[model samples]
Target: MGWVSRLSTVIRTQVNDWVGAVEDPEVRLDQAIADLQMELLQLRQSVAQAIATQKRTERQRGQHQTWAVEWYNRAHLALVKGEEALAREALSQRQSYLTLMAKMDDYLGQQRQVVEQLKGTMRTLEQQIAEARTRRDLFKARARSAEASQRLHTLMAEVGDRVTGGVFDSMEDRVLDLEAQAAALTELSQMQPTVSLTSQDSRETTASVEAELTVMKTRLGQG
Candidate 1:
């Protein structure tokens, strides 16, 4: 039972390794890069919203400052007319603007901090996205190079097998056959028989055959 459990574990490990090999790293890198880009896009939107808040704060501050200036003018006029209560009322109005100024100033300051932080975050995310893109390009190039090298190695292996299986030997044999035929043709071309066999020559050839037959009979007589 222990051995069976160990065998199953080994089999599962091998299957996982095979599956990992089948998965392309280039695709994974691209997906990761895409995810980063999406995050960067969201960050950019956040930065834009932060900037809008900053602008709105600046506009509100400007409007408040104008009211403050107008209220100051009213208080100055009331003092010039010698209306002490009117002067006090005008001063009270200015005090309200002062209180609002303090609050808006603090709120605007916080908003400024937020906007700056968001901008910094956007910058950092942009840099990371750029680095990721560069890494993705480098990895893809390296993968392509590795793939090409693997194909070349595979082709070399096939050639080695063909050489081992005697395909070249067959080609060598064919070349030898062609050379032999060529040599035979050359020999035939060189052979220029000057004399033709006449009827008398044929009779002499027949006599030569008969002489050989008599010699063969004499030699075989001991048997």
Candidate 2:
């Protein structure tokens, strides 16, 4: 019996602790949602950064193309003027610009790929967040229902303990015994209560009765 009582106490305490923890599920779910939102925001920022980089690369490519054209034009003019050294220098500059333009084109292509990947990741995350929201609510509801069930089980345990000869049962028995004793005493008192009241005793009794009547009236009014 001692071991059984101790085990019951432990189980009740653990269930109470678990029910108390149920309130935190909502907080945990919110934190999860917040974390996902932060990730999405960071991903969006990365996408924006990639787009900015792509735009800068495109602008650089366009500038290089323009520079190459200008250099080619200068090279042609120098050749027409019979300036071979100047024509050669202009053609070399134009080749360098064409090389840079080609590299920039490749970089731009890679940047586009990165941007597309970011978009795909963002789409996946959005879908995941939506799914998580649904799951979060379901999880919270289940936690709440489980907590209520645990409380009901605890209450039943307490009632069962009272019914099965625990302290509460003893207390109930003591109350019934006292009630029976009081009934016996009352019957004895009623059998012998025929004494006549003297004038002074009657006056005191009247005063006491009046005071009790006033108190009862006041309580009734308040109620």
Candidate 3:
């Protein structure tokens, strides 16, 4: 049972590895790049929201400062009018605004640092994406070139097989047949005898002379 379990595990691992090997690298690379882009998009949105919050905080802090100044002016005017109690109350209001302003200043400093960090991260991601795109293009070109070479080799292999099985043999046989026909025609022409007008005239003259000799011999015979 333990051996069977180990075998099953090995088979499953091998199957998974085979599946992963068959998966296209280009598709996986594109998907990884897309995921990164999505992450960057989300990060940008986060940065935008953070910046909006930072701006809102800045406005609130500015408003607090304005209120504080206004209160201080009121306090001074009240003192001039000899309203001591009112002046103290106004001064207290100004102090409360000042405290809020101090807290806001601290928060603004922290927010600025955060925004700067986010911007820096966004820049880094952008640069990485650009580099990834360049590498992807290069890899895709190499893959296409490799595919073309493979196809060409496959075609050459098929052609070689055809040549061995039929095409080349048939062509060679046809060429040999044509060469044999040409040689036969040349032999036949060489074997044929050629007669000229001079040969015909000499043969006719010899035949006539033989006939005259035959007639003379017949006449010379004693009758």
Off by over 4 Å in 3: 1-23, 163-166, 190-203, 206-223
Instruction: Show the colliding residue pairs in model 3.
Output: none
lDDT of 3 at 136: 90
State the lDDT of candidate 1 residue by residue for 38-148, as single tens digits. 988898898899889878877887888788888888888989999878888888888888788889899889988988898898889888888988988887777567556
Residue-wise C-alpha lDDT for candidate 3, range 1-223, written one tens digit per residue: 3444455456556645644553478788899899989989999998999999999999999899999999999999999999999999999999999999999999999999999999999999999999988999898887667556655555555555555566677899999999999999998787654446568789999999999988888899932
Per-residue lDDT over 85-171 for candidate 2, one digit per residue giving the tens place of the 0 to 100 score: 999999999999999998888888888999999999999999999999999989888987887787777676656665664787789
Candidate 3 TM-score, true structure as reference: 0.76
Clashes of each: 0, 0, 0
What TM-score would candidate 2 get against the native? 0.57
The TM-score values for the models, in the order shown, are 0.74, 0.57, 0.76
Q: Tell me, by TM-score, which candidate is best.
A: 3
Q: In model 3, how large is the Cα lDDT of residue 20?
A: 52
* Candidates 1 and 2, the one with greater lDDT: 2
The lDDT values for all models are 0.78, 0.87, 0.83
